[model samples]
Target: MLPQRVRLQYEASVLHPDSLIGCGVRRIPEGSTERYTRWINTITQDQLTTQVYTSHGPTVVMPTWFCSRNWFQRVGPFDEGGKGVPEDLLFFYQSLRRGGGVARVDHCLLVYRYHEKAATHSVLEETIWNLRVDFLQERVLSQWESFTIWNAGKQGRKLYRCLSPANQRKVKAFCDVDENKIQKGFYTYEESKERPKPKIPVLHYKEASSPFIICVKLDMTGGVLEENLNSLQLREGADYFHFN
Candidate 1:
């Protein structure tokens, strides 16, 4: 049976004359692995927006997505990168980029079967990371004059190094709670050929500035990072964006 939530979301999405795309997802995964299920269920709004900038978070499979033919045609023709390509994510990102809106059914009306050898498993982690960074640069960083990167850890440092030189120059600092990182004081760009190279300061999260590009993964810090973020009273999207 089609849940009322799904029906209502569809109705509202299509009722609009302008272009719209919606994902009516069953958050619960049937017969999925515990690790996959846990990660899927724990996805947060910030992480979702950071990942795809969609309100419905990241849909693991296309079966969870529902949209009209017209809207689909407008944003359809999913990336033909084939096999290892994250076609669903790319399409969803494009739809949103073209002024689309997302709403979730939040009910288990569909079943998601997970197994080894799935097409999703074929995609490389680096491919996903590159796509997300590109999207973030195009959508968010382009508008900001300067920003900080949260977490001075490996992931955070990698993000800084990978950013375009123009964007890299805009990184004001790296912030983290790790005493070891904070004690190091600054991150030196050893690869740069500049006479002095470049030194970016590392400070405690409380002392760091925003709007920040958070590289810390969600649900992994036992709420320590979340608590610090909350204490700062910084609004997601505006004051910060997650890259992790």
Candidate 2:
């Protein structure tokens, strides 16, 4: 029972009648039955870790998630808020909010479903966005007094506008490799309540100072980004973070 609970919780696959099966687990689809479900006595962490990444473990497994029954009582039960609440996602975020690590074991124990209208689809896109933004602001932005926004493009400016006012004032510069935005020299804060629009200087990526919050999306721009960042001699973590 311990082996079953620990092994298949993350990876869910049907087991065949010809193979070994656990008590109370039945009605597995024919041909869907996994060939390897023969009675299991013990399972190793490596096998488990592989399964974890294979299916639901990617969704809920934490590398260091082990608590006694008493601990569970202290941690409380599932948030049974039902559909549209994204109870699982909310719980994961709260775990992180309480200083939990994002982790996963390498195992395949659970038989996960590939459903069309799962609970995940019920959560609104806007809800996810707001949650991500709030988490990002809480986990990262609060630490820095100021940071330059990379790109100076539409997305970058949009992020600047979306930032809380205090964070907005911390935007020291707008930077880009594009000659057009760079040639313009500055981006005016047309929406600010100040008497005059705040003119934030735009600099070529090479010229712009570091400690940047990059709005640049990866795997796009034909590797021009790598070249630009390399030219600046700026190390990634020390000099910037991706907000894209």
Candidate 3:
């Protein structure tokens, strides 16, 4: 497996020198991080970039990362900020900003171990959340003049609050299927210091416009969210980007 990984990495490097090439990873405890493992392994080639904003951090897991020395040097000096700093994710984002690409070998070549005392567990979720939000703003949100958020719920509202004032103003509305939230009509920015405050409307998904920043988690809604999203026939990366 190690030799195969090296061979594939070398071939990929020759083919895509400016890309971060990763291979599929199998978790040590078999089922540990099952969904995440499945996601890492199965995401389409385009999703390597499209899905980067998710809580999953890098679409390609860090452990399987293999890139040319020149590309690595160009994109990094991974934050030597010690523990709790997500150096891999920071580097991955930096590479993307530099116009680098992401590719995968599609063969499971590494054993990704999961342990309670792992360094990853030391990093606070808030730290990652803030970073993801920042990257989303830089890469996706800045391109849009205005957009709707897919959920009128907690995660969506949290994303709205995290946006800069300019970006906050760009949020046209919050869209959801929940009758209670839609009946309430709008989400008032109670924490905003603005005079009169901001009250963004909450509407049914079918009534909302795109492009959207979908804050809804995939799979958890038992296909309801997927069904709602597909019903609109909108394109990903352009019409919407998943932030959950």
Model 3: CA > 4 A from native: 1-3
Winner by TM-score between candidate 3 and candidate 2: 3
lDDT of 3 by residue, 164-199 (tens): 999999999999989999999999999999989999
Q: Give me the overall lDDT of model 2.
A: 0.56
| lDDT tens readout by residue for model 1, 26-50 | 3334545554455444455334444
* lDDT-better candidate, 2 vs 3: 3
Screening candidate 3 with a backbone cut-off below 3 angstroms (N, C-alpha, C), the clashing residue pairs are none
Listed per model in order, the count of residue pairs whose N, CA or C atoms clash below 3 Å is 0, 20, 0
Candidate 2's TM-score reads 0.61
Compared with the true structure, all predictions reach lDDT values of 0.72, 0.56, 0.91
Per-residue lDDT tens digits for candidate 2, residues 1-244, read 2255544422321222111112222113432323223211122322232221111212343322443344234445657977766565565556445443332233343443334566777877666656655655676677887778898988789778877888788888999978999999999989899878788999987777878877786436777886777877876546665555
User: Model 1 residue 208 lDDT?
Assistant: 87
List the candidates' TM-scores in order: 0.85, 0.61, 0.97
